[model samples]
Target: MLTYEEIMLLITALASVFSVIAVYYAIIEKNLVRAVVFSAIQSTIYAFIYYMFMAPDIVLVYIPVAVGLYPAVILILISKTEKVEKQ
Candidate 1:
């Protein structure tokens, strides 16, 4: 049987992998909106990792800042800039 900590470690590892992939995709995305969305997805995965670490306070703060406010700000900036990359 996996210990609780070991299970959490496993989940954390998965989340880390997912976050890396999400970030990489975000980086390569030509569409600014899509990139912002992908960044939010990565933030959401980080929030889950935070929750798994038993840090609800961090999750609370991180979700709004990382996943919500940050993305919204970027999207707003994108609206003022360009929706899609010119290539």
Candidate 2:
């Protein structure tokens, strides 16, 4: 069996990979809403990694601002403009 630290490292590594994927998709996505969703996904993965690293305080603050508030604000701004990005 893996030790606690090893397991945590593994999880953090996986989460980092997923966050990178989310960021890539967010950048390439044509729809503004979908991009926002992808950005949120990336932020959530970062929060999880933060938790894995035992940073509860940072995670607590990050969850609301990055995962919740920032996305909500971006979505509202998106709603005001065109849904799809023009080439």
Candidate 3:
């Protein structure tokens, strides 16, 4: 059985891996808003990793900026430059 610290490390590693995948999806997605939302999901996972490391301050800031404000701004910008995708 792994120790508590080892398990936490594993979880952090997995979070980073998933974050990378989210970033890849964000880059390839045709929809700008969907890509921004995927990036938010990635940031949320990173916030969870920070929380696991006992860093509440980072979690608070990251959650608001990365998961909340950043996406909101991007969504607003997308709305302003709205273009219909051929599907």
TM-score of each: 0.91, 0.94, 0.88
For model 2, what is the alpha-carbon lDDT of residue 30? Answer: 92
TM-score of 2: 0.94
Residue 22 accuracy (lDDT) in model 2: 99
**Total backbone collisions, model 1:** 0
Q: What tens digits encode model 3's per-residue C-alpha lDDT throughout 19-87?
A: 999999988888787888899989899899899999999988899899889999888888898733446
Give candidate 3's TM-score: 0.88
What lDDT does each candidate get? 0.93, 0.94, 0.88
Query: lDDT value for candidate 3?
Result: 0.88
Candidate 2 clashing pairs?
none
Highest TM-score model number: 2
Per-residue C-alpha lDDT of model 1 across residues 9-30, encoded as one tens digit per residue = 9989999999999999999999
Better of 2 and 3 by lDDT: 2
Number of the top lDDT candidate: 2
C-alpha RMSD of each candidate structure in angstroms: 1.1, 0.9, 2.1
Model 2 off-target regions past 4 Å? none
lDDT of 2: 0.94
Tens digits of per-residue lDDT for model 2 on 1-87?
Answer: 999899889989989999999999999999889999999999999999889888999999999999999999998898888889999
